[model samples]
Target: MNSSLLKNIKTLFKDTFSAEPVIIASPGRINIIGEHTDYNEGFVLPAAIDKGIIAAIGKSEGPDCTAIAIDLKESYRFSLKEVVPVKNGGWRNYVLGVVAEIRNCGKEPGNFSLVFGGDIPSGSGLSSSAALENSLVFGLNELFDLGLSRQEMILISQKAEHHFVGVKCGIMDQFASMFGQKDKALLLDCRDLSSEAFPIDFGDYEILLINSNVKHQLNDSAYNERRAVCEKVAAILNKEALRDVTHEDLLAIEDRISQANLQKCSYVIEENERVLKAVEAIRNNDIKTLGELLFASHHGMQHLYKITCEELDFLVEKARENPYVAGARMMGGGFGGCTINLVKKDKLESYKKLISESYKQQFRKECSFYHVHLSDGTHMIQTTE
Candidate 1:
């Protein structure tokens, strides 16, 4: 736990509401091998990480709710009976969405004062939005005794994003953040939300991310388009989803779709297989084999999915040259984002310096890096005064 963050939230709560507060920690997540497979109802390998969002919340005595975003230093006030998302999809939209979904689910939570913040890097492909949504819902569920199950909370969080935040996201982020276990990666079957824990042991290597910070204007539209293309192929093949379509099935219906859509469909099918392979390799401690799969996934994303940006491509190409780097690939919805890398412990510094210099020399913008580890999912802490 982040003691300073906890103290800060508690202080904010006390200073604002002059009362005790309940605290909860909701962690961000990283997909080890799966990329963009959730929407297709395929398999994904995700784990909750140590970096995450934390909330300190307390019920007020009125019908109005107030929230302070500790990091943004902004205040949001709204009525519990009239919660609405902010215009322009700001951060408050996430909170408002959660509140709306909770109410929609027949939970009439009273007015509350919430102070929330997180250490998860924004736009670093760490699912910070999910962290925030999960934290709020978890805190509210505990604070109000909503009597919602874990799975119910997960659905509410996902709906909050879709209906409130305007992002048609799959359930991977919420599910991972809610159910993640320490030192383990989840092989989630997105079709049915079933998962199995796979143990991870990097031995001499560590997981690090290199953020490109180059979100393009086409990110949203491109993502929706890619998703539509995949769905179209599935419909043409007369399958429920891409998960139901196999490699051979995709080929049988290749001429029915465009060449571009064919490439996209192929990537999803193969990436699903790669995720399962990655899990098997984890069971056998085949780190090198996992690295090779990572590289292959990156190739498919860059060429087939057409999601990666030049900065991401550059980072992967440069990272691949280092013998210490076992695996590297562009993460998140792509266009421009971070590349998750696995580096030998001893070569961590050199790898960072080399990637930093190469990235700067090319893009003229410094790249950011975050070293993360697998961690427990969302849970509350009883703070002892």
Candidate 2:
């Protein structure tokens, strides 16, 4: 956890709770390589980062659920019996969504007082919302003896975001938040919901995230549009998602799709192959090959997917130009967000300084950067002091 965020959580608890409340944490995630492949039922390599949402929660006597955000300094209350959507700036939608989803699933919703905060930079492609939702649902699941397994909880949290929060995301964010393992990245098959863990064996190297600080609200619509286009192509070819199509299949009927849609379909198909190759590289400890795959993925995203922006493209290019960087690519929904890069461990500081100076000179905006570690997923702890 970020020390500042930890200090704030401690101060909030000291000021508000006469008794120590139960503490629960769920980690945010960084997609090390895969981009936009989750919805296409392709493979993704993601790890839960050290940064995440931490919640201090306690049961309430009444039927009303109350939650306060230490970071935003905002408090919200809702009736457990009558859950209604907040009209504006409802950052609490993630929490409310979970409650509504659990209730809809024929489960009883309970009341609680929750105080939460996180160090995960919002809009940095780190899945902060998923961390928040997963933490809250996990806390509630334990507090109420809901008897839900990890996968069940993941699905519930994902459903909450899709139905209540209104973002059509796949299960990846929730799965990583709930099931991440330290020093390993998860290879998730978005099609069958099957996954395997792969050790991140880049010796003497570390992952770094450089936030562009430009929030891309258009991501939601663009994501849906791309998904629609893929679906259209799939329908024309009489298949499911692009995952069903092989590279040869794509080549054979490449002209059946429009130029733009063909590019999209090809990226998804080739990206799936890249992901498999990345897995092999990791298993064989071939850092150089893995790095090349990262660069190739970014090129596909920039030229084919057309989701990458100038700033993100610039960051990737800058990182690639540096001899110390193994690989770099724009992560998450991405009109703008973060570029996930692997930098040589011994040269991390120098690499950061170089990138920051160059990025600032070119973009005229200082970039926010974080060194992240693969971390354990969600867990609950009872605090007694």
Candidate 3:
């Protein structure tokens, strides 16, 4: 936990609302593997990371809400009854969406004051949006005594993104943010929202995230388009989702769908299998196989799913060229974001320096690096009066 950040949020809320507030630490997430397979009812290996959003919230004296984005130095005020998305609202929409979804669940939420900020770097493919959403929902649940389960809270978070934020994201981000345990990666089945936690031991290698530092507008639209293609292909095959289609099954009907759709379907099918294999690899302590799976996953994303941007590809390629890197792949709803790399712990600094210089020369812009550990999901911190 960031003690300084938590203190700042508490101070901000007290200064704004003139009252002590309930605090929640909602963690951003990193997927070890399994990228676009979430919505297809496939598998994903996601872990909540140490960096995330901290929200301090309290009930308003009246029926009005005020939220402050501490990091952005912005504030928004709204009626509790009129929980609508703000036009051109970036972060406000995430908060409001949570409130809206909670109301949809037939729970009455009073007006509240919110102050939130986070250390999770934006556009780094670390699910900060989900973290923020979860923080607000979790905090609101506590403040209102809504009696919502963690499972129900995650669904509200997911719907908040879909309805208010306009991102048709899958439940993986919210689930991982809500349920992740420390030092473990969740093998989440999107089909039933069930997960098995596996100990994430990379031996001498540690997880490194290389931020390409570029976010194209194509991310959300491209994500929606790809999801549509998956659904269409699944319907054509008469399977419930791509998870039900085997490699041979996809190959059998290769002629029926467009080549583009074929590639998308093929990647989803293969990627789901990779996730299953990844769990086994972890079970066997085969880091090499795990690393190879990461590389293959990126290849599928680059060629088949067609989501990698030049900056992202450059970072992954740089990791591929490194002897210290066991595996590398672009993480998140790619256009430009971070590539999750498994790097030798001893060579971590040198590798990061090399990649930094190389990426600067290649792109003429600075790329960021984050060394993140798996962490527990969203939960409250005791507040001091």
**Cα TM-score per model:** 0.96, 0.94, 0.97
On TM-score, the leading prediction is: 3
Candidate 3 residue pairs that clash: none
Model 2 Cα lDDT, one tens digit per residue, 303-322: 99899899999999998889
lDDT of each: 0.88, 0.83, 0.90
lDDT of 1 by residue, 257-330 (tens): 77888899989999999999998888888889999999999999999988898889999998788889999999
State the lDDT of candidate 3 residue by residue for 1-385, as single tens digits.
9999998888888877789889999999999899989999999999999999999999889667889999999998899767788887888888888989999999988888999999998877898999999999999999999999999999999999889877878889999999999999999999999899878778899998988889644324588899989998889889998889887877888888888889888899899999999999999989999999999999999999999989888888888888889999999998987899999999999998998898899889999989899999999998652
Best by lDDT: 3
Give Cα distance to truth, residue 138, candidate 3, Å: 0.6
lDDT accuracy of residue 16 in candidate 1: 82
- C-alpha RMSD (angstroms) for model 2: 2.0
TM-score of 1: 0.96
Error (Å) of candidate 1 at residue 350 is 1.3
